[model samples]
Target: MSIVIIQGPHAHGLASGELQRNLQPLALAAGRTLEWFRCHELRDFVACVRSAKRRASEFMLLDPGELGLQAMAHPEAGLGDALDEVDTPYVEVHEDASTELGIQPGQHHAPVATVIINGDIGCSYRIGLGIALRQLDDEGIAVRAA
Candidate 1:
């Protein structure tokens, strides 16, 4: 399957490169394809989702990071609305999301997301991608187009 991962700017010094390193190998070995996009703004986040959906990717992995706060602040019809309109099934990703970290869980309960995966840095991305790929496989969706 082909999945799109939308990553937001990390807070608390988590490096974004760590996620890619973990996910890319797993995907390649599984005969899956991945597209990773890092978004620093709400508009870019929404557009990346639209781009992924338009490209017919089977699933999306979203890690809104610090941007989650921005989304929660405007839940009435802002980023959440954009996500709803895009209509791509997504799993919310939280890297290094231990409660001891005290990060606000803004998008955890987002209505549009299929699931939320929280784990150590880099680990959550791998797990979220696995879950998304399995969900699509369970649904009998074909692997990504060549």
Candidate 2:
């Protein structure tokens, strides 16, 4: 079991660059490496989740950019439904409350998320990842890390 992150579309490359820098140490210490996917379309998100389910990931980290917006704009889109296909726990992450692009925490993705984090991009991911790792540990999945 390992970690997977599926993020929504974003124009800012800095967020990812910074996120990688912040996550590297955490991942290394955990004795884990993350598989990351940047989704360009909502279907891509579903497909990625299904893929994670197939792999039986320890947990999933989701950045619901357009997915959150889609959920709010059209509840019929079944974003939540798609997520339900995977039993893997998910940590929902959002950009800092101060400079969010389109989505914010507790807007729509709240109901299904195992944990919700809102803060600086890298920090939010850091916190979310930490929480996920701890959860895995608590569940006795492994102390090696989620």
Candidate 3:
């Protein structure tokens, strides 16, 4: 199955320029090209996800920590509400997947296997992503964050 890795400036805490620099190496390592999209609205993002699913057999989302941070910044905005509303499968990143599972970081590791719905931000941003990733991993859904 083909895999799709989606990450953008908005996904990370950095501005577009910084994100571009960070992603450049990742793009090279992936040994494939990525389709970069600037998210102006939620609907457009959803459409892009659908398109990706259609193009690839397996879709892997690489969500930078910023999107979750923004949601946390504006809790009233209901950052996750839109993604939840779309009814898709997705996952977020984790700094210490082992801690959440109560295991060593390198041993007896449980790979994330479910769709993550994120609403994390700032210092706890990674934590929020970890929670959603674990849940989705448990459910065995691919990740797609907007």
- lDDT against the true structure, per candidate, is 0.66, 0.67, 0.39
| Model 1 agreement with the true structure over 55-143: per-residue lDDT tens digits | 78877888777776666565542565565556677777775343111222464224223333454646666667778767776666544
Runs with alpha carbons beyond 4 Å of true place in candidate 1? 96-119, 141-146
lDDT: the better of candidates 2 and 3: 2
Best by TM-score: 2
Candidate order by lDDT, decreasing, is 2, 1, 3
User: Tens digit of lDDT per residue, candidate 2, span 32-146?
Assistant: 6788888877777777877887777888888766465665566466666566667677777776332222333444333223333443566668877987787776778554565
Instruction: Give the winner by TM-score: 1 or 2.
Output: 2
In candidate 1, which residue pairs clash?
Answer: none
Error at 50, model 1, angstroms: 2.3
- The number of clashing residue pairs in each candidate reads 0, 0, 13
* Residue 114, model 3: Cα distance from true site in angstroms: 9.3
How far residue 88's Cα lies from its native spot in candidate 3, in Å, is 9.9
RMSD to native for every prediction? 5.5, 4.9, 11.2
- Candidate 3 local Cα displacement, residue 145, angstroms: 32
